[model samples]
Target: MAYVISDDCIACGTCIDECPVGAISEGDKYSINPDMCTECGTCADVCPSEAIHQG
Candidate 1:
């Protein structure tokens, strides 16, 4: 499963930097490109709001 950014995301850009594959991108709530996501859970680890989840 890929990581999905939830509405709780404040778009703080924290997860973006943690993404090893650069799958995270800026958006209304920030977005994860499923194709690019490796399901590494890196973004989830760095997300201050705990907004990234496995889909």
Candidate 2:
């Protein structure tokens, strides 16, 4: 499964730099491109809001 960014996201842009596959997109709450995600969980680990998780 790819990592998902939930509404809990503060859009801090922390996860963007950590995504090895560049799967995260910036916006009001941010979002993960499931098709590009590698499920590495790196973004989840770096997310300060803990918004990123496996889906």
Candidate 3:
């Protein structure tokens, strides 16, 4: 499964750059495109708010 971004995201833009597949996008709370996500967990590891998780 792909990783998902939760509401806990602080919109810090940290995950966007961390994603090797560029699956993350900026928004009110940042979003992860499942179709693009490689489930590498890179974003999750860098998210300070711990918003990204396995789906």
- Residue-by-residue lDDT tens digits, candidate 2, 1-55: 9888888999999999988878888999999998999888999989899888898
Off by over 4 Å in 1: none
Report the C-alpha lDDT of model 1 over 1-55, residue by residue, as the tens digit: 9989889999998887777789988978899999999999989999889988999
Question: For every candidate structure, what is the RMSD over all alpha carbons to the true structure, in angstroms?
Answer: 0.7, 0.6, 0.6
lDDT of 3: 0.90
lDDT of candidate 3 over 1-55, digit per residue (tens): 9999899999988988888988988999888898998889999999999999998
TM-score of each: 0.93, 0.95, 0.95
Residue 29 displacement (Å), model 3: 1.0
Candidate 1 Cα RMSD after full superposition onto the native fold (Å) = 0.7
Poorest stretch of ten by lDDT in candidate 3: 12-21
Model 2 stretches with alpha carbons more than 4 Å out = none
